[model samples]
Target: MRRPYFDLIATGAKTIEVRVGYAKICKVAVGDSLRFTSSDGSLFTRITAVKEYKSFDEMLDAEDNTGIGEAGMTRDQLLAACRDIYPPEKEALGVFALHLAPLPE
Candidate 1:
């Protein structure tokens, strides 16, 4: 996650962790506990839900911009950002919508 997105998650403003890397994230299942670290700090989160998509665009449509909006990004910005990280060819590999919540402190 980027700093802004990480901050959003830390502040509970964002709930879904979107990943463009399908292979690694696909192995993560619901109920899995994951740790995230950022400049803000580290926190433990439990995966509440996991949805797979055929492409980032598909995931974006399914998410309805809620996650991207939370990160202060518009749909086009989000798409361009994702493309910057992972090329459009890789986008077809799919995406993971990992719904997350903070674990008990």
Candidate 2:
């Protein structure tokens, strides 16, 4: 999660947690529960759905800015930011989109 996106997740404005790393993608499954902490506070979330993509660009195309909007960023900025974090080679490795919902406290 990124700054405002982290905030969005905390506030329930964002409900998807996107990951391009194998470590996270491999471990998570639908019905899984996760806890996260950020400057806003702590959050508990449940995985409701999981989607896999062959590439980040493909994922972006399918998503059509839904996640970016939740992050309060334009498509270009989000893409650029992702590129900065994940180079082209890594992006091509693929991504996982996890649909989330707040879990009961």
Candidate 3:
């Protein structure tokens, strides 16, 4: 996680976590625990739902932008941001939308 994002998650502003379908990410499932950390600190969240898509375009279309990314971000901007982090080759693998609920500490 990075700034603004990590901060959003901490404040419960972001409720969905998106990721590329890498080998490790593919193993995640509903009910699993995720620890999101940044140099500042960390927050624990539990998976409430898991959605899979063939690409970022599809994922962005199917998931809510506010929950998955910065508030007020347009889908196009979010899509571009996702691509900036993940190239087309990586996007070819797949995309996953992990619905999250902050866990009790």
Candidate 4:
């Protein structure tokens, strides 16, 4: 994860982790736990839900931008950022919205 996104997730401001639907990621179940690591540290979160969409635009329409981006980021910026990370080839596979919640301390 990028530092900004990771920080947002760490602070409980971001709750949705977006990724391209790779085969391995598709295998992750709702109850699975994920560990996100940054230079600073690592945080644990549980997958609350898994949603699939044809494109990032479609996923953005259904998911909250606030949960996927930094404070005050516009939907267009969020969409562009997602696209920048995952190219057309990857997006063609699918988009995955992994709803996340922090594990207990």
Q: Which stretches of candidate 3 lie over 4 Å from their true place?
A: none
* Per-model CA lDDT versus the true structure: 0.79, 0.74, 0.88, 0.92
Tens digits of lDDT, candidate 1, 43-69: 889999998888878888888576553
TM-score of candidate 4 relative to the true fold: 0.95
- lDDT per residue for candidate 3 within 1-105, as digits (tens), equals 788788888899999887888998999989999999999888899999999999998998788888977878899989998898899999898998899999977
Off by over 4 Å in 2: 69-72
Q: Deviation in angstroms for 105 in model 4?
A: 5.6
Tens-digit lDDT string for candidate 4 (8-45): 98999999999988998889989999999998789999
Provide C-alpha RMSD values for all models, in order.
Answer: 2.0, 2.3, 0.9, 1.0
Count residue pairs with overlapping backbones in model 4.
Answer: 0
**RMSD in Å for model 4:** 1.0
What residue pairs are clashing in model 4? none
Tell me each candidate's TM-score.
Answer: 0.83, 0.79, 0.95, 0.95
Clashing pairs in 2: none
Off by over 4 Å in 1: 69-72
- For residue 69, give model 2's deviation from the true position in Å: 4.2
